[model samples]
Target: MKKIEYGMDFVARNLGIFKCPVCGRSFEKIVHKSVSCDQGHLFDFSKKGTLYFLKHGVKSDYNDETMWQARRNVLQAGLFQPIVDEISSFLSENRSLRIIDAGCGEGSTLKYFENKRESNKDIYVGFDISKRAINLATQGEGSAFFCIADLAQLPFAANSFDAIIDMFSPSAYGEFERILKKGGILFKVIPNENYLIELRHMLYEKNDNHYSYSNAEVLSLFKQHYPQARVKRINYEFTLKETSFEDLLYMTPLHWGAAETKIDDALATGLAKITVDVLLLMVEND
Candidate 1:
């Protein structure tokens, strides 16, 4: 079909950026919309408009349609535009950059960089272990390419990217070090203590244990991998609409352990605004 061909065309043109997720080897050829490696591992771009590179069990806890849809709606509402702007500004100097968004759910966060560019010089590849997430990600047109793949073992060749972005996602430092060229950056975002404070406060009693968040352990782990990594906190508040009450609850992990009763109460008594507190980590592979 035309859709499949369009997806194939992209792989054929930029074949240098991909590798076999199974063998971790560069492709030998890309013919008839299929990429074949030296060892004979071949993968084809799907008719569903995504590339298939996940060799192992492709399952994710974050693969819920309702949750991803709520996330998409919240992002579209400009609640996290400030963080997007910060990332875009950080990479503005690179006219042509090869970027990857690890654990990219629905792909809006990665698409922000592509849309901000004056030209389509940036190559943005975003992948999540969730098939449902990647399916929704590929539905849009942009500088981004989506796939259902694991982060622990990335499917790209060594030194293939200029930067890897992990927004509110898990970090794979070992895999990250392998794929990034020297001087490349790993742009990661983690929550600050006050992130979604309104929700936490409403869900728990005053000064509850869940209300406390410390980045000390996270920072220590980052330093253990990249000693030169720098951290910056982007903190602010976004006014919430009563209509976004449900979407906000679904978009965050804060409700993953909450009871239905608590969730309903928060929905009924929603905050007019919530804080967007996050820490951005910048680490050069070198």
Candidate 2:
């Protein structure tokens, strides 16, 4: 089936989970290739098999196709497999699950879980604000659904998901709480100091602020929200292949604001390995 047709069918099967972005009413099955609520809020699935739930388009540095492709390649290289493994273990608790990857760029992480599914009953939904990222995520359309959605205003209904994964993305804790089911898990990943330290040093050699990184504020904020949250520090170094190193430079936000000349200069420094230091915060709804 065409991607658009497949997406419409998928959305039809999971229509109960969706709520209208405007009216807050539940969405019904696909009609005329679009899903609409009683109040007349209609959304069409894109040709690439994803839905856009934004009233106004949002601009982000991660919206570029090159950046998303780089991210997918780097992730598939197994650099972030440890983190994926950690989350996957928790997901195994339930025989059937409904998972939402909040801010899932290119859907690489969701694709990992989809591949590991033991049955077709598991529901994997990945949403990002980037259209290009969601477009790329629809390549195979095996068992995952992709959407362009806002974190603060999720299109899914209250208590819709079994787990929510927020990896290196901004957290809309209130929205997360609303959409996640009772006793659901929230896996939040934040970068720690020394995460890509080589690139930081090369890019901002003279600027002390840019060269130094910290997760103190993020940690404090998360603790405030979930005091009993379980935290794990994942620190390691990944030996980079030449191609992987190039993808790293393109994928990371560290190089987002850096000039092309500066990036070229950083590339000249020569990095064989990069630090993958991050904290995984796990909290369960009571």
Candidate No. with top TM-score: 2
What 10-residue stretch in candidate 2 is worst by lDDT?
Answer: 112-121
Candidate 1 ranges beyond 4 A from true positions: 92-94, 206-209
Clashing pairs in 1: none
How does model 1 fare in lDDT?
Answer: 0.80
Best by lDDT: 2
- What's each prediction's TM-score? 0.93, 0.95
Q: Write the per-residue lDDT of candidate 1 for residues 71-115, one digit (tens) a residue.
A: 888887778889878877777464588888888989888777777
TM-score of 1: 0.93
For model 2, residues 7-50, the per-residue Cα lDDT tens digits are 88889988888999988999966778789998888898778878
